[model samples]
Target: MKSSEADMVFPVLGFTPDGDIWGFPDLDTLTSCGSMTLKKNMQLDMELVDSRGRRWLVRSIRRLGRARPLVPWLIDLLLTAVPRFRIEQVLEEMTPLTLEEIKARASAAVELTSEYYCAEDERDEILVPLLDQVRAASDVAQIHELLGLDSFLSY
Candidate 1:
């Protein structure tokens, strides 16, 4: 089932590398594919706080596998100076789906990513708890809160 238009706030959904997923509450601040009116390349400047309470400006590239290698090279160069670093490439467009849909997708992504980097024992200890949080969230706000973005965004 589709989500009500009224329930549609922000279209840009963020997933942290550390296994937290959140959607921006401020629709005005989100630069979603559906909202961008410009023809030229657009840059999404997103700010997120890690578990350590350190703030990070995560620059997302809308078109993946299309940018000149120099762009990412430059970003890598810049990250050398900053300890906190994150990079996101838009893999697909955001669909207007219910919270359940979002959760399912996020959970699947988390599982896939976890499988890629985790050992067998590490998977049970780390991946299970993260996936459980996504499954247990009662609402979008709860998901954001569980992810710790609610506190991060407060400041």
Candidate 2:
């Protein structure tokens, strides 16, 4: 491949979960191709339309860094439950912190939560147990109830 074509295959701001480089065309081409690659890999095709009304196929790949080992169960547990109210309640119960401090804490919490979901190992272990604790907390239950399941359940 010529340098130009090679450049098309690889674009800027591209990194895989394992820290491998993913090369693509220019930003537009990369965006188009990333969608195609994800769809092909996932065996599910979805239509993606650009602002100009051009249609493209797409798929999504879950990328986890070193934090890959804790995601799925985390998603299944916490993400499935917690609502915004519970989050706010937890924040309030933890004692009044400044908004900036709360944001920082929330960000860290989200990162840890995402890490738990991205984990590869399905087996229950130390991390899983701790995550389960968070999931099982009363605040989490309130959040789940607030979110509701009526739409998800159909008669």
Pairs clashing within candidate 1 = none
Model 1, 1-155: lDDT tens per residue?
11112233343355555554445555333322221212222333333322222233444443222122666645744664311112132332233456676567567756756655367789878778877988886665565565443212111
Q: What C-alpha lDDT values do all the predictions have? A: 0.43, 0.28
Give per-residue CA lDDT, model 2, range 1-155, as digits (tens).
Answer: 11122222111212223322222223333322222233234212322221122222223333222111356534534654421110000000112233233223323343344443346464355445444543443432222232221210010
Instruction: Specify the highest-TM-score model's number.
Output: 1
The TM-scores, one per candidate, come to: 0.39, 0.18
Indicate which candidate wins on lDDT. Answer: 1
| Model 1 lDDT, full chain set | 0.43
